[model samples]
Target: MVSVRDDATMREALTAGQSGALADAYDLYAAAVYGIAVRITNDHGAAEDVTQEVFVELWQRPERYDPGQAPLRGWLCMIARRRAIDWRRRQVTRDRYTLLLAGQALPAPNVEEDVEASTMAKLVRAAVHDLPPLYREAIALAYFYGLTYREVAVQLGIPEGTAKYRLRTGLRRIGDSMSSVRAE
Candidate 1:
C-alpha cells in the first residue's frame, strides 16, 4: 500500500542504480528481515547471513520487487523466511551426512543396539515430518513450542478441544508408524 510518492526515491534508486539509496533501504529494513530469519533459523549467525543475502538480492535484482504489489518490508520478510527455511533444510541434511560418515569411521561397542536406535530415531523423525499440515501445526505448537493445549489453541486461534484433538491424532499417527519399528 505504499503510495508512489512514498516510494519514489526507492524506485529511482532501483532504476538509476544509486548506491546511497540501496544503503538507506538496507538500514531501514535490515532489522525486520533479520528478525524473521532468527525466528525461523534459531541461529543468530545464520540469521545474519540470511539478512545479508536478502539485501544483496534486493540490490542485485531490484526489478523483482514491485512497490504496487506489496510493501518493501513485507516482501523482504517473505524472502528472508524462505531463505532461512532453505538454510535449515541444508543444515539438517549436512548434519545427517556427517553423522553417517562418523558412524562408519567409529563403530560403536554395541553395533546392533546402535543401529536399532538410529533406525528408530529416523522413523520417528519421518513420521513427524510426514504428518498432514493441520495436525503438524498443532503438534509443533503444543510439543515443540511447549504450549499447553489451551495455550496452543489460543496461539493457533482454535478451540482448546480442537487443538487437543489435533495433538492426539498426530501422536496417534506417529505411534502407529513407530509400532512396526518397535516390533522389529
Candidate 2:
C-alpha cells in the first residue's frame, strides 16, 4: 500500500491500476469534488452524479491528468465544475422544453415577457395536446424524457424512420396551427 500522503506515489499507483489507489483518491478528493458540484448545480442529486462521473473519468483516463500542469485535486475539481455546468444547462433546456409543451408559459431569458409570445405558447401547448396519440407519444418520449430518436423508436416499438416522421409531423402541425393564428 502506497502512503496516502504521497500524492505522486498514489497517482503512479493509480496509473498502474494498483488496488486501493482509487479508494484513497476517493477518500482524499470526493468531498471536495462533491462540494464544487453542489455549488454549481445547486442540487444534491446532480452533485452526486457529477462526482461519480468525475471519479469515473479519472479512473478511466488517468493519463489525461498531467501532474506538472496541475495537481490531481485541481484536475478533479476542474472536471467536476465542467460536469456540473453541463448538468445545469441540460436541466435548463429540459425545463424550457417541458414548459413549452406542458401547458406552461415560456420563460424569456433576457427580454421582458411579451404577451404575444405567451399567447403563442398557449397555442403550441393546445396543439400538442390535441395531437393524435401517436404523435403525442413521440413528443413525450423525445422531449419529456430526453430520449434520442433511436431510443424513442426502441421505447415505442416503432421504426427509427417512423419516429423521425412523427416528431417532424407533430412539430409541423403545431407550426401550422400557429401560422393560422397569425394569419387571422
Candidate 3:
C-alpha cells in the first residue's frame, strides 16, 4: 500500500501513468474514498461510481496534483465531492419544470411530524410535508439520507441540476412555512 503522505512521489507516478503506482494508490485509498463517497452520496452504486470516476479523473489529469499544498487524498476527495454535487444539481435542473409543463397537480404530501423532537422539529416536519414532491424528495435525499446531489440524481434517475433545484426550492419553501408557523 502506498503512503498517502508522499504525495509528491504519487503525483510523479500518476503523471507517468505507472499502473503499479495507481494500483498501489487504489489499494491505499480506495476504502477512504469509498467511505467518504458513501457518506456523501448515501447509495452504494453511486458511491462506487464516484469512487471510480475519481481515480479515472486522477489518471486523466495527473498534473493537477500539487505537492506543495494538500496531500493526494485531499485532492481526490475534493474532486469526488464536487463531482457528486454537480451530478445532483444537473438532475434538479432537468426535472424542475417537467411536471408543471405536463399540467399535473403537485402530489399530496406524506410527511409526518416527528413527535419525539421539540415543537420546532414538528413544525419543520410539517413544513417539509407541505413541499412539492420533487422538493421533498430532494431534501430528504440530500439531508436526511446524507446523499450528495450526484447520488440523489443517480438514485432518482434525474438530472443533477434538477436535484439541486429541488433542494434549493425545498429548503426555501420549508423556511418560509416554518417561519409562518412560528410567527403564528
Candidate 4:
C-alpha cells in the first residue's frame, strides 16, 4: 500500500495547482501512459495525443482522483484508458458517419444491426476503457490493431505473460460489454 505521506504529497502537489508538480507527476508516469496509448492506437501520433490529454486531464480535474482508493499510478492508468477508448469511439463514429453520408452502403444494416453496432461499439469501448491500462492496451494492440502478443509486450516493455493477461482480461471485458448491449 502506498503510504499516506506519499498520497498526501501527491494530493498537495495537485491541489496546490503547481505546474511543476504536474510535470513531475507526468515524468513519473509518462512512459506507462504512453505505452498504454501506443498499445491501443498503434500510432505514435495518437499515443502522444493521448499522453498529453492524460496529463492535461490530471491537471484539470485532480479532484476526481482519490488516493485512498487507488495509487497514483493506477489513477493515471485509469484516466489513460478512458481517454484512449474515447478517442477510438469518436474516431469510429466519425468514420462510420462519414462513410454512410457518402452514400456507400456496404451492407444493409437493419435497424438492429445498425444500432447494435454503434451502441455496442460504444459500450465495448467504454468497458475496455475502464479496464486497467495495461490490459486495455494489450487487448487493443492484439485485437484492434492486429499486433501479436509478443509485439505488444515488446512495445509496452512488459513480460509476455503480463501482456497475455491484459489481452485476456480486455477480451473478457469487451465480450461482457457486447452481451450487455445485445441484451438491451
Model 4's alpha-carbon lDDT is 0.76
What TM-score does candidate 3 get on C-alpha atoms?
0.52
Candidates sorted on TM-score, descending: 2, 4, 1, 3
Q: 21, model 1: CA deviation in Å?
A: 0.9
Q: How displaced is residue 49 in candidate 1, in Å? A: 0.6
lDDT of 4 by residue, 70-161 (tens): 55665677677778888888887888898889998655548988886887678877888888777787876665544567767765778998
Worst 10 residues of 1 by lDDT: 1-10
Residues 1-184, candidate 3: write the lDDT tens digits: 4565577888888899898888987887777677777777677887899899989888888898786754566567677777777666665555656767888765554455443356678788889888888888778766654567876676578999988877888999998997777688
lDDT of 3: 0.75
TM-score of 4: 0.55
- Give the runs in model 2 whose Cα sits over 4 Å from its true position: 1-5, 111-184
Q: If scored against the real structure, what TM-score would every candidate get? A: 0.54, 0.57, 0.52, 0.55
Segments in model 1 whose C-alpha atoms lie over 4 Å from true places: 1-5, 104-184
Better of 1 and 4 by TM-score: 4
CA lDDT scores, all candidates in order: 0.79, 0.81, 0.75, 0.76
Better of 3 and 4 by TM-score: 4
Give the lowest summed-lDDT range of ten residues in model 4.
1-10
